[model samples]
Target: MPSLPEELKDLESKLQHTLRKLESIQKALDESTIVVITDQTGKITYVNEAFCRISQYSREELIGNTHRIVNSGYHSREFFKHMWKTIGTGKIWRGEIKNKAKDGSYYWVQSTIVPFLDERGKPYQYVSIRTDITRLKQYEEQIKYMANHDDLTGLPNRRFLREQFSKLLKETKEEERLLAVYFIDLARFKNINDSLGHSVGDEVLKQMAARFRTVLDQKLFLTRVGGDEFVAVAPRVNYQSILAYVRTIQQMLARPLEIEGREFILSANIGISVFPFDGEDLDTLLSHADMALYHAKEEGKFYQFYHRTINQRLIRETILESHLHRAIERDEFILYYQPQYDLFTGELIRLEALIRWYNSELGWIRPDQFIPLAEKIGLMPKLDEWVLSTACRHRKMWKQRGGVEADLSINLSASHFQIPGMAKRLLSIIESNGDDPCRWEFEVTEHIMMQDSAVVYENISQLKEAGVKLAIDDFGVGYSSLGYIKKLKVDRLKIDRSFIKNLPQSADDQAIVAAVITMARQLAIDIIAEGIENETQIQLLKEMGCKGGQGYFWSPPISETEIELLLHGAE
Candidate 1:
């Protein structure tokens, strides 16, 4: 118990200091890393407290067991083979590893395994260190999902569609089977958007997409390529089966959708194209499907299959669409004036302006041929502006020629009607051309008005306030209720030619025409009969007290020069 020598005392103090340093190092390692030591054969020998906590196993349970006990099965045999090759050669192996816990939960880690070497420089034991990266991996997976899926409908997006289509097409070709690519368009969805508003329209689309996904079965892949447009691919399908599937898809789309307590029915135009038959490539297949969809809508059918004929029509339409913008710049559009007369007096009261395109290369493209194409390509607004400005100028010139005083009626397409500031734009065009707003009338069909939007009403109100007359064209051909017509506050109603052509012979037509005239008179709205070809139809119209009329009988659509001679003041 006596005091020791100074040298021995100093050695004892240094030993105690070294032992404390080792203890601190061990504590630090226990707190930070998930450490495990295994024999070369992968049997666990030691595990730190952190490792046990992560794997939900006690140290005693982990030791003496194989590392395979915690295998998540997420990695392939090849992955493990590469890992083993690295560590077995006494080299440090680093990788991201996913492991399963005792309670069947998963975790991710960035791991490093260091192999301990024997005298022969071969591995005898391995020491592993891991940093828990489960949260980071989860975030990465979520980001990937967002990138591949549409935010609105939660369906696969265009990017994902292309990826899957590429993979699926390869698989189909290898399996020697045909694949069907279907392009679906929600018909008249714009009417819903414009009338009910975008919010309701979104809900309707969601409902449609949900129904489509629900009934599609596991074999088909559905994607939302864009607004109101969905693309789907069905593998291992043939002509008969593909046609049956299309019929089912269309019926599903046609199902009623309830929005804001009202039942709404939706219709879709579906276009189908087959792999290797339509085209072997993705772009070609999509293009052919789109063409078939256009043809389906053209034929007023729910679905159409791509054929060589559709390809030809699509090429022609494409050429026309590509040139429409230039057509306006080149002054290829002309206006024809169809004169309306007093039924009894044959007095020219008004002239309806019709647009006819004279493409320099194509030579006189029909309005029906190019207008819908123009509308699709966003050229209708400009084309409409050009037509209106030209018609106004023609009317001004007619006035200069022989004092023509009849109102000039120009048709405003639905595409132009949807423009935000259409009324003000029209007013500017009218005043610029030295045309009287009161003497110039705008014709909008009932189908356009049936949309019943606040914007439409506002535009109409603004036009009328500026002394422009508005008429409901093709009166009975649309689905508008009488309430909408009353709300329009238009100056006149033009009886659709359908009712007039068979008048005085067909009882139903006679009754409808008579009722329309009587209603117009009661409402103080002037009625004009359209498409009067013979004298008997004119007589019947005159007797019905229809004050104004226009048709082939008076004169077919005439040029601006011919209009001057037809003016009452000229003669």
Candidate 2:
């Protein structure tokens, strides 16, 4: 061989050094990256050590097999088509892909595929460089899941609900089916959460979510919107089918739950709105459903369907509720007295005080309109205080001028008793007015007696101990147990007006009245039939051995001045 020239020798040395650098680069890539070389038709020709380790496959097993051996089926066929089209044209394709290993575990990779081209600009082979990003992908998925699900119950959350609502709405409309959106509020959930700790509450919520899931069909979606409130969206076949599904949910949730060795019987109030009927938009539908829920809770119904009248009524109530906070400060409240008479002799025995509101902006709002509103708005305690103080003031006025010989009966709100030591506070109000507590009767609904609260029990006990008379108003219409009546040692059972309105006519009402009277007599408790409108009802009550009654027949709830006139006639 001829000896090389100096220029040729230096050029060959540089070329050798450049080859060494390229080899070093290849070695570094093989160690760090999952590298694979494939023929133009996608037959795997070579796989680096990193590719073998990540794929849990030997080089021999991966080679000549193509990348399909690691296909996870996560990416769509179209996704792979796009990548192949790009690489086939001698362009680099960069993307993230999910692949399965030989052990059947899935891994994610950040991949870049570069096509080696012939001089004709056609691809002859492809080299793929992939970075194992399985952990990062998992972390991203975890973040996405946490953002869309509730932490306590691990249920899809409100944001997820909103996102899915549009899709569900579109599907329902396309199928010409009704999409039912159920807004569920767990009744008495706050009481449980407050009495028992949040840990117990959280466990109860989780159990509730699990039970809810068991009842839901695969097409139905349940999301925990917030504390003790969940929403379910489902496509229904018809009105009847949706109602049947609602009943099924009610029945399922009615089953008793146990947590931390304590058994709980829970109930839910559900409000529903249907797409294309109640509303067409997500926000409108959800708003209407929430309005229906308010009415469900207000009317004490298990579930309520959305109607246009509910929105109107809710709007009016909302306006009234806004003004109600100032009604007390504005002195818009007044009390009217109705005489309770002895059934046989027509002698006035007691005066029932009824509250009425006369707002300046909204004139003459009925007690039926604002009393429950007061209770709902947490104004009952303050209103009760005003009633107590005002009643005492009126009695002091009546006694100073040839007094009336009748006990003053005032209706007490259930929420008033929820306040701790409220009974003592009320007694102090009566004492401060220099009135005789013995001459006053505090009447509460039978529902109040059924509340399982120490504060309510203590309040009732304190009132009874202070020589104030206790009466169970609306006796037969509520959930008050016979044992509760006996336990409270109530002085009177006021038969509800419903039974009295159709008395001596409807056999059911008559039987209920007679049974209640007999039960009250056997319990050695006094009974009064209210809403007495006719002599026939009065005569029948006398025959039933009822001693006292009050109704519109004798006198409608009257002003204090009119009550004084009735007192003069009685005297």
Candidate 3:
């Protein structure tokens, strides 16, 4: 054994070494974590550099204060009370805390509070170690918000709407109030989106969301369900009140919205379903409202309510759409020609080609019934192609069978002119079939001229330049714009059958017909009075200076062979 003095020196050396290790540990903790020490009364006694830096406070400022100096008030009093109770009983407490800095900025921390106990196992002072988790909490909150809100418009998303729907339904039931679910669809929004780029489309949607917000009252909530569609929920409303709200929505949306320095006149078809009357559940109510919206769009109306008849109509339409997809390949469509004659001489002037469909399953569908359906399902282009091709084939046959030098009038869909190179495509179809453009007159409605598309104007101009005859079909019934008439420089204005059906018998019809004829003559355009069924009507049209017409009085729309016989006799 060594001497007692030497042993004392060794013990002192070991104590110094241990003190150095403890100081190194304290420095590491100060650098890596926010460390603060307080007395048994919760008054701060010391704070490390990390604590002062994270709290945006000087050590001198925090030394005498409690943790309440940085309290954010984000937690309930009970939360802090429970935390203090745990540490005050000589126990360590672990949890997350939200705290505010001296600059009023908020932060999050993962905190562990430890109590230093006295010999009696009672708390003396507390030490808190915290790790900053502000960034992690922000990421979590961002994800949550993204899940519940629309990124483009900052409105509640469809998922959030569905989540809140049940709660609202419960409240509505308890309060004995009605709820109206409005399915609003923007009309012709596709045209805007397709013609312009998506950036403009997105801006349009954002502006619409802002406008919709202006109309929202305390009882109403609006949600963007998807592209060009929004749902408005109105609670505590009766039928009349719901209608009033709909009118408000209509009027608010009707105001012209200027986007990207261009003005757009917007309209929406609103479909409404009242609670406990139309449906009790969200899905059912939304479905019914959608059905109403479909009917409103079909009927050219602003708003409609749910009814059972719409369900049946929707079913038939769904079946028809499915069948129309296979119509061309199945060769279920045919063209019938109706002859136009000179009213004074009873001579054949031209043949108007009308389409007729005989589906294998749905037999003998009228043109009026299937034509609009075809247009709705985006099959108009294909149907128009078929019509042009078949009409050319018939004209070729007529020429081979010693035909007269009369034009073949074919009604064209307004959609045809929407294509960029529509004139070239159409003329290619006719020329490929060995037909002359001069022998064909493409008849278009007055609404076709109202499209305001550069493509439409370009196509019409191209057709006119290529020697194809253009005529305005159903003239008086549509929006009669004198500008469109003069701009198009059409070859003929076919007097709408409505004015001619009454003829000399009805003075209003005669006055309308006579006015149309006079205007056509002044414009150097020919006029054809259609739906003529008697000698008196023919004489009246001749007296009005109308050149030609076609109706049941001369011949109904006849078959290819029947019109071919008429063609031979006309020669």
What's the ranking of the predictions by TM-score, best on top? 2, 1, 3
Q: Is candidate 2 or candidate 3 better by TM-score?
A: 2
* Model 2 CA deviation exceeding 4 Å by range: 1-31, 39-41, 81-92, 114-125, 190-201, 254-266, 506-508, 568-571
Model 1, 15: alpha-carbon shift in Å? 5.0
lDDT of 1: 0.86
lDDT by residue for model 3 (370-452), tens: 88999877788888889999988888877887877568889988887888998998999989998888888999888886687
**TM-score of candidate 2 to 2 decimals:** 0.88
lDDT tens digits, residue span 1-571, model 2: 5556977998999999999999998789878888999999999999888998899999999999989999999999999999998998788999999999999999999999999999999999999989999999999999999999998888999898888877887788888889888899999898788888889999899999998888887778899999999988887457887898888888887788999899999988899998888888878888899988988998899999999999999889989999898987888888899889898787788999888988878899988888888888788888888888998888878777776656898998877888898989999999999987898888888777647688888988898888999998888777869777777778999999999999888999998999989988998899898999999999999999999999999888999888777776766
**Candidate 2 residue pairs in backbone clash:** none
The per-residue C-alpha lDDT of model 3 at residue 393 equals 86
lDDT of each: 0.86, 0.88, 0.88
User: lDDT tens string, model 1, 73-173?
Assistant: 99999999999999998899999999999999999989999999999999999999988999999999899899999888999988898888888888788
TM-score of 1: 0.87
- Ordered from best to worst lDDT, the candidate numbers read 3, 2, 1
* C-alpha RMSD between model 3 and the true structure: 4.4
